[model samples]
Target: MSKSDNLNLPIYDNRGKPLELAYHVTYTLRLKNGYILALKPGEHIVRMPNLLATDVKRRA
Candidate 1:
């Protein structure tokens, strides 16, 4: 996928509200699955393949 394709993913706020624009994107990381993770002032947004699935496992 291209950079422009990555930008097509929908962004959401911390409260789960869809956002039209994401300003001051402090950091961006590309996930192994080709999704982009974007972080702003108050929250981090990522486009996952399964929104309802819990992908992260905590290590103790």
Candidate 2:
């Protein structure tokens, strides 16, 4: 595993909606420029479209 690995962390959207992080998000990353290399399969991978929320303490 690399330093970028988050160990399948939970991800949510800005609207407080739970998102199913999966391998389908690979297309968003540029494979040629090397901005991203590969994505972890069968794990909850957070994409840029979502936010990595540690907790909901800020919720009203």
Q: What are the lDDT scores of the predictions, listed in order?
A: 0.42, 0.37
CA error at residue 46 for candidate 1, angstroms? 13
Model 2 regions more than 4 Å off: 1-6, 21-60
Clashing pairs in 1: none
Show where candidate 1 strays beyond 4 Å. Answer: 1-7, 22-60
Please give me the total number of clashing residue pairs in predicted model 2.
0
lDDT of 2 by residue, 1-60 (tens): 647755443434323344455654642222321123233344333444323233345333
Q: What is the TM-score of candidate 1?
A: 0.30
Top candidate by TM-score: 1
My TM-score estimates for the predictions, one after another, are: 0.30, 0.24
Q: What is candidate 1's lDDT per residue for 1-60, written digit by digit as tens?
A: 646533555444443444455455454433333233444565554444442233243112
